[model samples]
Target: MTAPDRFSFNQATAKYWPIPELVAGCVEAGVGQLGLWREETNAYGLDKTAELVRDAGLAVTSLCRGGFFNTPDWYDENRRAIDEAAVLGAPVLVLVSGGLPEGSRDLDAARAHVGEAIGALVPHARAAGVRLAIEPLHPMFCSDRCVVASLGQALDLAAPYPADVVGVVVDTYHLWWDDQVWAQIARAGREDRIACFQVADWITPLPEGVLLGRGLPGEGCVELRRFRDAVEAAGYTGPIEVEVFHAGLWARPGTEILARTLAGYLAHVD
Candidate 1:
């Protein structure tokens, strides 16, 4: 089968690759799209990175984050994120709903707050013409990283808003273990709530914090192609972002990482 038309290499997969090299490497590897993070884009100066990607004739598929509603400055922060996404020509701004607030154990409240938080940002996001994509991190990250833990939950949070402004992210690495994901993908398709589709393999013997233990496609147990098929079946015709986050993978040279990423996608996902 041919590779997906919207294949994108998320920069987080090659965490330490310098911005210029990452851009050059993607171009050399025939990658036409990218998923960028706030930190990396900031480090490179958002405008400069925007210019670089534009000059390379690459599309900024999605920006990695604009959530964490539990924080004090979430509203302003997310507005800035939306504006930045607009400037970078990214259509979606992925939101990682943060975990419980400090010393708080109210999971229900945390989730509710996320919905309200996204609701508040909808106006700005719509004004900027940038969609806010809520990403459901693995439930393993429930306590510290993200509270929204399933595709269904993410879709629920997005249900109240206009489909163009709020949506959910379907990352295979995080939702692969959930049996209900197929149904949720169907629901997402029916509702037009799928904003981004990310891919990564699930590997075992996780690291100390368990934040960066991911594998390239075909290196682990998860069925990458199945997830790809499900997303497309869900009526998602947008970019397919490869977002593996392995420390070992990150240590490699940027070009090697890009080449391997392309090969992995071809072998396991295409």
Candidate 2:
């Protein structure tokens, strides 16, 4: 079956897929949308990757990241990320707020810093025509990766900015366990803060890193269709990016992975 109109394949799902091959495979599979990560694009030469995807008629739904507020150079780093998003025509730059600063256990302070950092970058992001999307990773990542661990907090952080300037991502992989997520999703819609929507299922026996433990759309227990319906009901009619990150999935051929992703998305999400 053909992918849904809103379906977007995040390149990370096929982590090992080279840019050229990934683009070719997407074209062959009739996939028209993609989500990109910085490392891969930077390695392939941003401009070259941009040109390749543009020429192939694939639209970039969002760029993987631009946040890590705990870092000393966050301001400059995020500005560069905004520039790159503009270069690639991605409307949104996903921000993964960094964990607590070394030796600091103040969660409140860390989250507060995330808001301030976004406020600082708003002007640049606005000038570049890119929206800053705050992504709240699972609380498990709180100490070392992302401290903003809930959609409620993400919305709170975005409350100070214009809805167009700052928004939040609704990723099932990280948010499915929250009972308040439904309410938060509605609030996000009413507030116009839902910038990007992604899907991945939660599986047991997480891998060593935990970062790569995500399962494809239906492989785990998430209510994929329910989340899809929630976002749609909340008035978000943007791309629905499948962003699973598992080593086993990545080991498959790019086209094969894309096919499986499409199947899972169709069966469980669309």
Indicate which candidate wins on TM-score: 2
TM-score of each: 0.97, 0.99
Tens digit per residue, CA lDDT, model 1, 101-211? 999999999999999999999888988999999999999999888999999899989999999899999999999999999999999999999999999998887776678
Clashing pairs in 2: none
Candidate 1: C-alpha RMSD to true structure equals 1.5
lDDT of 2 by residue, 1-270 (tens): 677889999999999999999999998888999999999999999999999999999999999888988989999999999999999999999999999999999999999999999999999999999999999999999999999999999999999999999999999999999999999999999999999999999998888889999999889999999999999999999999999989988889998999999999988988
> Model 1 residue 148 lDDT?
96
**Candidate 1 has what TM-score?**
0.97
RMSD after CA superposition, every candidate: 1.5, 0.7
Quote the positional error of residue 101 for candidate 1 in Å.
Answer: 0.8
Candidate 2 vs. true structure, TM-score: 0.99
Q: Give candidate 1 regions above 4 Å deviation.
A: 1-4
| lDDT to native, each model | 0.91, 0.95
Candidate maximizing lDDT:
2
Lowest summed lDDT window (length 10), candidate 2: 1-10
